[model samples]
Target: MELLQALQDRRSIRKYKDTPVGREAVEHLLEAARLAPSWKNQQCWRFLVVTDAAKREKILAGFGDDNPGKKGIAAAPVTIVVCADPAESGIENGIHYYVADTAMALEHLCLAATEMGLGTCWMGLFNEDLIRKGLGIPPTFRIVGITPLGYPDQDPKPRPRKQLNEIAYFEKWGEN
Candidate 1:
């Protein structure tokens, strides 16, 4: 699929079918993430894929009941725990490159999922300590985010977005 079409078709899916995501499909998404550019090519990002039901339950427990993606987490056949090693990246002008690099990789993962006719929802708000302990993640690694990947069960309309004029400027910040 074309990049723009994939971008436009992508949505934060909260519902999934009782279907399994094949290992090859999972690998394809990972390949896209692996190709994403990182600061100094250090590749700080790491993906922990959870497919077991019991483990998914544990991850869900870390999320609050009010989390919008709770149902998706429970239903998805795969959930990728995105982590980053801050040591692999640097900080410039108070900006952390580790997060930026990881985020770019996550976007690659999500877009690849969309192009493959799969669904994913980027989840972030949760108890990090619980996730780190439950998932046995290293204390040094930062959990950048989690995203449920599966076949979508619902067809959602596109959400609103800011106009280009409102976000982009011709020459200056305020010049729309």
Candidate 2:
């Protein structure tokens, strides 16, 4: 699928079918993430693919009951934990590049999933410490975000977005 179509089609999928995601599709998504650019090619991103029901339950423990993504995490056939090794990337101007690097990779994975007719919801706002302990993640790696992967059960309409003029400028800020 074209990049723009994928971008337009991608949604924060919250409902998934009981169907299973194929291994090849999962690998394809991971490959898309692995090929993403990184700070000085440090490749700080790491993905932990969780498919076991019990393990998914363990990860779900990190999320509060109010989190809408919790149900998706429980329903999807796969949950990819996006992680990053901060030391592997650079930092400048009080900004951490590792987070940016990992986020781009996760976006790539999400787009790929969208192109493949799969669904994903980029989710944060969970208890990182609980997730780290439950998933047995190493101390050096930070859990940046996670997404549930499977066939979408619902056809949600596109959400509203700000106009380009409102968000972007020609050459200067506030000069749209």
RMSD of each: 0.7, 0.8
Instruction: Report the error of model 1 at residue 159, Å.
Output: 0.9
TM-score of 1: 0.98
lDDT of 2 by residue, 64-132 (tens): 989998999999999999999999999999999999999999999999999999999999889998999
The local distance difference test score of each candidate is 0.95, 0.95
Residues 3-94, candidate 1: write the lDDT tens digits: 99999999999999979999999999999999999999999999999999889988998999899899999998999999999999999999
* TM-score, every prediction: 0.98, 0.98
- Clashing pairs in model 2? none
- Clash pairs detected, candidate 1: none
